[model samples]
Target: MGAVLGLLVVAAGCARQVPPDLVAGAPATTQAGTPAGDIAVQVLRRYLGTPSENSFPERAFPTVYVMDHTFGDAADPSGKQAGGAPIPAATQQRIAEALAPATKVVFVADRETVLEHKESCARVKDDAILITLGPPVGDARRVTVGVNGFVACLGATWLTYVVQYQSGDGWQVTGTTGSMSIA
Candidate 1:
């Protein structure tokens, strides 16, 4: 009987070990000093999806988009200026306010990326936004999130986002806007 009890204890200890698959598949968590891009991508993935029928029956879009921008040039790095309507000043101001009380800020922008792997959606020039926030002082216990996007079936969409970390509370969405045309 004692031998059997010892064996059971050993088996339980082994079972407590984390599985290799779970460790590999686990999503990265936000830390106090996580990079801006990492935080942005994490936030974006969390909210990427079509809205429910009751929310917006006329417009439903995909969750992921084709990322074609070069590294480090996410926010109009060319300096020549691309052809598309810029994000409105009022909207931009709101985004800025959402990311208040931060030590640093990063900006990213891209154009001509396809949305939801759909060829027709690609032509629409959909713009997506993602924001990530960190704690005020010590390591962040959680992340604050704010995302917005506009998908125009007939026209172009503009995307922009900001990341900030200072020290505060759990993650929350401050603002968001999205639309897509079916016809």
Candidate 2:
């Protein structure tokens, strides 16, 4: 198992960086089949690379799992409200339901979708997830989930993660502080 995991990591390293110029005219998109957990890390790296920027690069598909930022509590805080009113607790809770350890994380297993190199890689272009944890603004929270061969990150850090196509919003489940493993 260790050898296999190591090999997967080594193989991932082979993916090679996509130069800015090539990112647009590249012959292919990032192939799927990568563990959801691995894709989760890429999401983090994306957020870390550029803070306060919202993007939904479809090419980053199969990577449906997202880790972005918002402003709200476990259940509708001031940040996640309408007309300045906090969002309903039930709605907020429902959104965070994925935080449970028992929650199942889904992935896009469609080989065709995964391999389609010419697919339109558009941004999320919506305000779907609009909540995070703790005080508004600088007060960030770190939400994580681990289950069903997947993991995620959530918090003031601007990350909203969810298993691809699976119902229910992303969760804020807890796991090792910095421990990691590959599927």
Candidate 3:
């Protein structure tokens, strides 16, 4: 038994352990510090490493648009995203306010303006990340919300996600409906 234990120790010492895949520099999250804001941050965290044009960067933040709502809102001028549940007004305000400090969370209200502003996206260093939040419905301990992270630049890219979060705990990405890029 002693010899076997000694052999196990030797083998363990010979094995090499790999370090966790840490972000090279500061971790970049969309966290705005509010309950919903933090939830959005978690959503962004989940999307960061996925296959996308602007994959996760070695940074602490990314500028994203904070729209009026998701699923069904005037944010999309085409009206295809209409007839969906709207995010509560108070909740939207809270998220926008919380996110303002870390990034420029704009509410352009229409797709035309979004496109218009796209011209200066590179100049201003904006990633064109539009975060349209859905109605955050939940009880005291848990909540679920819809979020769309759309990029108007690079021929456009988008991901519509539903996130469920436990109050005072971690986040859960409930859904990733679809993604598309024009070019």
Q: Which candidate is the best by lDDT?
A: 3
TM-score of each: 0.28, 0.18, 0.46
How would the candidate models be sorted by TM-score, starting from the highest?
Answer: 3, 1, 2
Q: Which stretches of candidate 2 lie over 4 Å from their true place?
A: 1-32, 54-183
* lDDT-based ranking: 3, 1, 2
> lDDT score of model 3?
0.40
Assess each prediction's global lDDT (C-alpha) against the native. 0.27, 0.23, 0.40
Instruction: Tell me which of candidates 1 and 3 scores higher on lDDT.
Output: 3
RMSD of each: 19.8, 19.4, 17.5
**Model 2 Cα RMSD, 1 decimal:** 19.4
CA RMSD (A), model 1: 19.8
The numbered model that scores best in TM-score is 3
Error of 2 at 98 (Å): 25
- Model 1 segments beyond 4 Å from truth? 1-32, 42-60, 68-155, 166-183
Give, for candidate 2, the lowest lDDT window spanning 10 residues: 1-10
lDDT of candidate 1 over 56-88, digit per residue (tens): 335434322322111111221122232312322
- Global lDDT of model 2: 0.23
Across 1-183, the per-residue lDDT of candidate 3 in tens digits comes to: 000011011133542111101111212221323344455445545554354523334433356555543443212223355433333444445445655565555654444555445446421235456554443333222333334445544433344444554456655666554343232
